[model samples]
Target: MTNEPTIRSIIEQELERRGYSLSSFASRSGINRGTLSAILNGNPPKPIAIRQLDLMTEALEQPEGHFYPLYVNECVDSDQPNRRRVKAFLLRCAEVGQTECIQEVLDRIVENLSYIPMIFEIGEELYEKGLREESRLFYNVVIESEKYQHSERLAISHYRLFRLSLGDDAEANLIAATRFELYLYRLPEDYQLDGLLHLANAYLTLQKWVQTEIYSDELRNLAKMVYKNYERAYLQGKAFQFRAERNLVVYYGQGYVLKGIALQFQRRYEEIPEYIAGYADLSWFVGLNESGKEEVEKFKLFAKLNTYNLKVLLGDQSIIPEYIESVKKHPPEILPSLRVIVEASNIHNFFIDDILEQFNIDTGLYDRADNYYRLEVSKDRYLRLFYHLSVYYLRKKEFEEGISKILITLKIAISLKNYNYFMKLIPLFERYRSFATEGQLKEYETLLEGVIKDA
Candidate 1:
C-alpha cells in the first residue's frame, strides 16, 4: 500500500548519505549490533520499543517525535498489534498536533490483510472512550475496506453508526438506517430481532410513521415466535440456554412502547392503555430479577408518565394528580421524560412560573436531557417543547419571544409532516393575536393562514 520508505530503508539511506557504517551508527546510537541487524534485515520485521526509539532518534540527530507517526503505522501494520502501546501512541499523536497522521496511518494499513480487523478494533476502542467522530471514521474505513463485508464487525459497525447518527441529522439518519438494514439483511434469521428494533427506531425519527408501524409489528411478531419456541423447547426437555440472553421481558416491553407511540400518533388513543398495561406487566417481571431492578423501576416511572399523558387526553382527571405526584417524586435527571411532561402540563395549566422553573434546574440536568434527546431523536418532543415555550412566553406577555418560539415549532412541525399538531397551533396563534397590536395581529393571521394553505 503505502509508498513511503520503511524505517530500515530510511536509516540505510541516512547512513549511505553520511558514509557511515552500520556498526559505527549502531555503536553511536548505543543499540546492540545484532539487534539492529535483525531489525534492518529480518524478513519478519522487528519493532523498536518507544524508549530505545527515542534514544536512537536523538543519537541520529532527528528532532523529537519526528518518527512517531511511522511508529504508530508500524504498530497497526504489525501482525500482532500491541493495542496498549498503540493507543498511547495515538494519544501522543493527538497531543502533538499530529492528528492528521492518524488518517495517513489508517489509509496505508486499510488494505493490509491483518489490518482490516485491527482497524475495526481500534474503532471500537475509540467508541468506548466516547470519541464517536473518530470511531465513526475508522468504522467507515472498515466498511470501505470491504474485506470483512458480511462479518459480525460489519453488522456491529453499522448498528453503532446508526445509533451515533441519531437526533443530529435527518440525512445522516437515512444513511444510518440504510446501513443498519444492510447489516440486518446479512445477519442470520435468529439475530434479526434487535436489528428490526433499531430499524423501527430509525424510521420513527424520520417520521415515516407507516414504516415505523410495520417494523414495530415485525419486531413484536418475531419476539412472539422466539418466546413460543423457547416454551416448546422447555416442554420437550431440550437444553435451551438462550433465555438468559434473550430477556423476553425487556424485548416485549420495548416492543409495546414502540407500538404504543405509533398508535398514539395515529390518534388511536384507546389502544394505548392496553399497551401501557403490557409494558407495566413486563416491567414488573423484570423487576423481580435483582440485576434488572433499576431498569424495571425506570420503566415503571416511564409507564406512569405515559399513563399521565394518556389520561389527560382521555379527560380522566381523577387519576391525573396521582400520576403527577408520582412523577414529581423523581427529578428530571433520573427520569428525563418528566421534564417534557412537566413543562407541557405547566403550559396547559397556564402556569408561567412553573414553566420557568424548568430552566432553574441544574444546568447539568438540561445537558443530560439535551444529549438524551439527541440519541432518542424525537421530533415530536422537540416540537412540543417549543410549543410549550411559546405558550410560556405568550402568558408572560413577551410577544416577540412567544412569536419566535411558535415559529420554530411550526417549522419543525412542517418538517415532521405533523399536520395535526400544526392545525392545533393555528387556534393558539389566533388567540395570541388578541395580545398583539393591530399590525402584529394581521401578521400573525397571515402566517397562520399561509401555513394552513400550504398544509
Candidate 2:
C-alpha cells in the first residue's frame, strides 16, 4: 500500500482545492499565517500537538487521523520524553531561522539527551544560517551527552555532514581527522577499516599526507583481510573486482595526490614523479588508459584521467598532450567519459572551438554535460565551471545570461545544502542582480526565501 499523504502536502492541496489563500486559511483555522505557511512549504513540521492537529483538521473538515498518525507513531514507538516538543521546535526554527528558538529547543534536548538525530538535523539548519560556531558547539554537546549512546559510525557520518557545512576550515579538518583516528583505534577489528578510510580522507583534507598514508596503509591491509570472506555470492567475482577497483581509485590514486601535494609543499621535486607515477599507474589500472585490457576502457580512462594543466601554469612539465594523444589513439567506447577527460584536462585551451564543433554540442548540451560532470566529480569543479561561464558571458556583454547562470548555480549550491558554496555564491548573486529585471529580481527573492526557509 502507498504511504499516507504528508500532512503538509495534504493541507497545501486541500487549501488550494478549496480556493482559499494561505491568509484565508490561516484566519479560518486560527493558525498564524506565517507559521502555517512555513509548516506547509518549508522543512518537515515538528511533531504537532494532537490538539493543534485536531484544530487544523476540524477547521479544514478533514479527518484528524490524517494529521495525527505520524505524531501517534512518534509517541508510541519510543520512550524518549519530549520527542514531540523537540521535533516541533526544530521545524519552527527551520521555518524562521530564529537562532534563539533553535537554541532553546536544543537546550531541552541537551538536558534530556534523548534525541540525538534531531540534534544533527538541527545542526544542519544552523549550518545553513552560516552559524558554524554554534553548530560545532551543539555537535560537541551531542557527542558528550550520556543519555544518547554514540557510535563511531554515527559520529563519522555526522562529521561528513559537518565537514560539508563548514567547508575546508583547517581546525575542523584537524578535529575530524583526530576523531576518526580515535574511532578507528577503538572500533572492533572487523569494523575498523571503514573508519580508517574516513580518517585518511580527513587527514588528506588537512594536507597531513603522513597521517593519511598511515591510515591508507591500514585500510589496505584490512581490505586484504576481508577479501576471502565473501565467496559464495552469485556475482562474487564481479563484486570483489568492483570493491578492489574502488580501493585502488580511492586509496591509491587519492593517496598519491595527497603525497604529491605534500611533496610540492616541501619542495621535494625529485620525489614528485614517484607520487605522480603512482597516481598515473592507478589511473591507468582503473582503465584510464585507452589500450588498457578492459573492453570499456574509454569510459574509465576519461573518468579517471587527472589533468596537470594547472601544473603547466606553475611551470611543471609533468602533464603533456602526448599522454592524452596516446589514449585518444585507442579510445574507449564511452563518449561521455571521453568528453569528461577532454574537459577536465583543460584541453579546452588548445581546442575550445574545435572540441565544441567536433562534438556538435549545443550550448544547452554543454551546460548539461558540465553540470553532470560537476555533480559527479566535485562542487569546486561546478563552481569553477559556473564562474568561467559567467565571466565568459559577462565579458561578451550577455549580462542576463550571466546572471541567470549564476542564479541557477547558486540554487544548486544551496540545494546541495553546502553552506560554503552558498556563501561563496551569495555575494556574486548580489553583485549581478543589478543586471536583472523586476520579474527576475522578484524570482531571485523568492528563491532566496525558499532557501532560507528550507535551510
Candidate 3:
C-alpha cells in the first residue's frame, strides 16, 4: 500500500536521501536548527509559513512552488486552517504565478464559506499592489459566494470588477457598466459619488440617454446632500468621513453637466437650461477650497460653452460666433464642439464653412482622439462628429464632400461594428447615390458588401 505524501514526509525523506544533517539542512534552508527540529519532530507538528516552505523547497533542490500541493495539506488537512497561514499561502501563490495552487487553495477555502471576507480583503491588497489578474480571482470568489444580495463587500467587488474590466471596446464596457450600475447605491457614501459619476459617464459615452439622466440625477442629489453635511460638519466643529478622489465640487458639477448633456441629446432643450442653471453659479457654492474653487471655475466655463451650444441646438444661429470663439479658446474642446456645430448647421440650415475651415487642422487629428479625453469616450465623440459632418454636407447639397465624409463615416462605423450608424448612413448614401464619383461609388459598394457579410 502506498502512503500519501505530505510536506513533512517529503522533506524528511528528501533530507535523508541527501545525507544532510538537520543543522546543515537548516543552514541551507536559512531556517534555524531549533525551529526546523520542532517543525519536523513536534508531536502535532509546528505550523510552517509559506516563506519558510519556499526556503525548504529550495534547500530540497526542487522547483519553485514544488511544495505548494503538499502545503495545501498543511493549510487545510490539519485540525482547521489557520487564517494567517492560509491567507499568506494564498497571497504567495498569487505572487509566484501558481494559479493552479491558488485554485486548489481557493477551492478548499470556500468550502466553509466563511473565508469570503478574507478573500475579498486579499483581492483588494493584490489590486492595490498592481497584481490585477491575481486580484480578480478573489474578487470573483467574493462576488459569487457572498450571500447577502446587498452587502457592501459584494457591491465593492462588483465595482472593482467593472473598473478592472473596462477597456477600448465600448460595447464590452457597456456590459460592465450595466452590471455595475445595479450596485451603485450599495457602495459607501464616498464611493457612491464616484460610482454614480462613472455610471453616468459610461451611459453617456454609449449614448444611452435615459440611463445617463438617471445616474446624473442621483449624483447631483447625492453631491448636494453631502455638500450640505460637509458644510454643517465644518461649522459645528464635527468631522465627516465622506471623501472621493476628486474635489467634491467636481462630482457635483459633473452631475449637472452630464444631466444637461443627456437632455440636449434627447432634444429636451427647454429642460436643459434648468439643469444647466443648477451648476452655472457654483461660485456661490459653499465649499471653496483651492481645488474646489478651480473645479467650480471649470463648471462656470462649461456653463458658458453649453449655454452657447444649447442656443445653436435650438436653431438660434445668433449664438454661433460667440460659441465658436468660446470653443476656440478651449483647445481640447474643439472636436466635440465642432460635432455640435455641424449638427446644428444641418438642423438650422445655417452656414459654417469658415467655422469648419478654422478647425480643420484640429479635426484632422481624430486618430489621437484619446489625447483629449478617455479613449473610448473620445473615439465615440469623433465617430459622431464624422456622422454629423456627413449629414451636414449631404443636406447642404455638397454632394462630393458629402459622399467622401459619408464613406469615411461608414468605414469607421463598420470597423467599430456600429450597426446603428451603418444603417443610418446607408440610407443617406442611397438618397445621394446619383451624385457619387466612380471611385467613391466603388468603395461604397465594397463597404456595403462587407457590412452584408458581417451581418
Give the per-residue Cα lDDT of candidate 2 at 455.
45
What is the Cα-based TM-score of model 1?
Answer: 0.64
Which is the leading candidate under TM-score? 3
What's the C-alpha lDDT at position 316 in model 3? 85
How much is the lDDT of residue 263 in candidate 3? 89
lDDT of each: 0.66, 0.52, 0.84
Question: Mind giving the per-residue lDDT tens digits that candidate 2 earns over 336-454?
Answer: 32333344334233323333334432232324432323222243344445644554455556789867766766665565454555676678768777788787688788888997687
- For model 1 the local lDDT of residue 49 reads 69
Candidate 2 lDDT (Cα, 0 to 1): 0.52
Candidate 1 C-alpha lDDT tens digits along 1-455? 77988766786787788777768878888888888777778778677666566666777799877877667656676555675666555544544556567776666556665667767787778777777776777778777776656787777777667767765455566777876776775654445676777778777766677878888888878777776776677678786545223455545566777888778667688888887886674443412355456556656766878877676555454664566566556645323343345454553553435434544432333344434333345455666667776776777778877776676667666665566557767777767765666765566666667766975
Arranged by TM-score, best first: 3, 1, 2
Candidate 3: tens digits of C-alpha lDDT, residues 53-114? 99998888888888898888788764468999889988888888888888888887786778
Q: Candidate 2, 454: how far from true, in Å?
A: 33
Where does candidate 3 stray beyond 4 Å?
Answer: 1-48, 51-79, 92-101, 128-133, 165-170, 315-325, 360-372, 396-401, 414-417, 433-455
TM-score of each: 0.64, 0.41, 0.79
Instruction: For model 1, state the Cα shift of residue 242 in Å.
Output: 7.5
lDDT of 3: 0.84
